[model samples]
Each structure stands twice: as C-alpha cells, then as structure tokens.
Target: MTGNTHIVGGIAASLAFAQISNDNPVLLVGAGVIGALIPDICHGGSIIGRKFSIVSKVVTGVFGHRSFTHSLVFLFLIGALLHTLLTNDSIIAGILVGMVSHFILDMATKNGIKLLFPLKITVRFPITTRTGGAVENLVFAALSLLSVYFGYEAFAGYF
Candidate 1:
C-alpha cells in the first residue's frame, strides 16, 4: 500500500482505539500517521524513510523491504522503546495500532509481510491486491469511510 493508504488505515485504527483509550484525538491521529509511515522505513523512497535517511539506509541495507520492520520483532521492540519514552499509554497504543494497520494493509498486497520475521515465512490473506492498483484504491476508499465513521464516533458526544 502507498503512504496515503497507510495514513488512512492508521487514522481509522487510531480512532477505533481512541474509543477505548480516550486519548487526545489529535495526538493519537498524529501518532497514527507516524506509525503508518514508520514500517516503510526500510524503503528509502518511502515517506518516513526519506525523512530519516540514515536509519532508513541502515535498516534497508540489513533487512531489505518487508522483513524486519514489518515483523512482530520490530513491533515489540518499537513498542518497548515507545513505552519507555512516551508517558502516554494511549499514544503508544495508537501508534502500535497504526503499525498493525500498516501490516494488515501490506498483507493485502501481492508480496505480503513477514509478520513473524527471522523465520523466512510470508503471511498474507487468501486474496491479495496489487499495490496502488484499483483494488488497493477501493481499499483506500473503504478505509477513508471507516476513518470518517470512527472519527465521528470518537467525537460524537463531544461535538
């Protein structure tokens, strides 16, 4: 999936999680965007990758795309780091949820993801779509609608 898809997916996931965490919506959504782009750090051309080129280069050099960064290992490691650094558990939850959304979105692609990495196995759903293809666009649309719905739900009583 492209960056936009990840962003929308992240937003949707974050909003859903917000219902439980009750964190600041803005903070969670912003963290969601960061989380969405983070997994793509293995690709120097990706949004987060371009921003942090040195780390991107190193991670890509060692793990390549869709390997370590997309794995549960990276998730927990990042999760641990975020837990230690960020005082807000809700923000950490939003970020992790967004990252999980990224994994799920990529899992929809033809190449899939190495969720349980260092094991050399690829995991994907039964059906897959081409990245940036029509199906992916439809998925993007669906996620957009979901984001809207979740967003409304999150802010319903407040507004």
Candidate 2:
C-alpha cells in the first residue's frame, strides 16, 4: 500500500481504538501516522525511508522490502520498545494499533508481507490488489473518510 493509504489506515485505527484509550486524540493520531510509516523504512523510496535514507538502505540491503520490518516480530519489538520508552500507555497502544493496521493493509497487497519473518512465511488476505493501483486508491479514500468520522466521534466530547 501507498504511504498515504497506510497513514489514513493508521489514523482510522487509532481513532477507532480511542473508545478504549481515551487519551489525547491528537497525540494518538500523530503516533499512528509515525507508526504507519515506520514499517516502510525498508523501502528506500517510501516516505519514512526517504527521511532516513541510510537506515533504509541498510535495512533493505540486509532484509529487503516487506521482509523483517513487515514482520510481527518487528511490531512486537517496537511495541515493547515504545512501551518502555513512552510514559503514556495510551500512546503506545495507539502506535501499536497503527502498526498493526499497516500490516493488515499490506496483507491486502498482491506481494503480501512476511508476517513471521526469518521463517520465510508470507501472509496475505484472500483478496489482494496492486501496491498503488486503483483499488489501493479507493481503499485510501475509504479509510480517509473513516478516519475523519472516527476522529470526529473520538474528539466530539471535547468540542
């Protein structure tokens, strides 16, 4: 999936999770965006990868795209790290949800993702689409709208 789609999915996931965490919506959503983009750090051309080109190159050079970074192991490790480093559990939960959303979204792609990693197992949904194809664009739009609705609902009590 494209970074935009991943970001929107992250926002939607974080907003939906807001019903439970009820933390700062803005902070959760921001963490969600960062979480969404973090997995793509292996792809040098990806948004997060471009920002950290050297790291991207090193990761991609060693593991390749949709390999280690896309794995559940990576997600768990990152979540653990975040939980230890971040004082707010809500933010950690939001970030983990966002990263999980990224993994789920990637599972809908044709190439799929190595969910297990180091185990040479690629996991995907029954239905799949090209990375940045029309279907992905539609998914992006739908997720974006969902994010808006969920965001509004999550923050409604504040306003």
Candidate 3:
C-alpha cells in the first residue's frame, strides 16, 4: 500500500485506540502515523526510508523489503522495546496498533507480507489491489474521512 494509505490506517487505528484508552489523543495519533510508516522503512522508496537512507539501505540489504520488518517478530520486539522505554502504556498501545494497521493494509496488496517470518508464510486477503492503484486511492480516501470522523468523535466535547 501507499504511504498515504498507511498513514490513514495508522491514524484510524490510533483514534480507535483512543476510544478505549485515556492517553493524549494528539500524541497517540501522531505516534500512530510514525508507526504505520515504520514497516516500510525497509523499502528504499518509502517516505521514511528516503529520510533515513543509510538506515533504510542497511535494513533492506540485510532483510530485504517486506520480510523481517513486516513480520510478527519485528512487531512484538518493537512493541516490547517501546513499552520498556516509554512510561505511558497508551503511547505504546497506539504505536503497536498503528504498526498492526500497516500490516493489515499491506495484506490487501497483491504481494502479501511474510507475517510469520522464518516460516515464510505470506498472508493476504482474497480481495487485493495494486499498490497505489485506484482501489488503494479509494481506500485511502475512505479511511481518511473515517479518521476525521473518529477524531471529531474523539474530541467532540473539546470543540
């Protein structure tokens, strides 16, 4: 999926997290966006990868795109690391949800990810689309609007 779609998914996941958690919505959602893009860091053309080319290159060289980074092991380790480092459980939850959202979005693509890793099991939905294609764009738009609605609902009383 495109970065735009991943970002939307991330935001939506964070907002969803907010519905149950009392963390600062703004910080949680922001971290969600970052987490969503973190998986794609293995791709040289990814937004985060472009910003950190050396790290991206090294990761890609070692594991290749959509391999280790897209796996459950990576997600668990990252979540554990973040949880250990961050004091707020909500932030850790938001980031983990965001990263999971990324994985969910990628599962809708033709080239699925190795979710189990080491086992080489590629998981994908029967209904899939090309990356950045018309379907992906539609998904992105719908998710964007959903995120906005969720945000409004999340902070409705603030306004």
TM-score of each: 0.96, 0.96, 0.96
Give the lDDT ranking, best first: 1, 3, 2
* Model 3 alpha-carbon drift over 4 Å, by segment: none
What's the lDDT of the predicted structure labeled candidate 3? 0.91
Taking the tens digit of each residue's C-alpha lDDT, what string does model 1 give over 86-116?
8987778778888999999999999999999
lDDT of 3 by residue, 39-88 (tens): 99899899999999999999999998898999999999998899789998
Pairs of colliding residues, candidate 2: none
Per-residue lDDT tens digits for candidate 2, residues 32-83, read: 8888889999999999999999999999999999989999899989988987
- C-alpha root-mean-square deviation, candidate 3: 1.0
Question: Is 1 or 2 the stronger prediction by lDDT?
Answer: 1
Q: What's the number of clashes in each of the models?
A: 0, 0, 0
Best by lDDT: 1
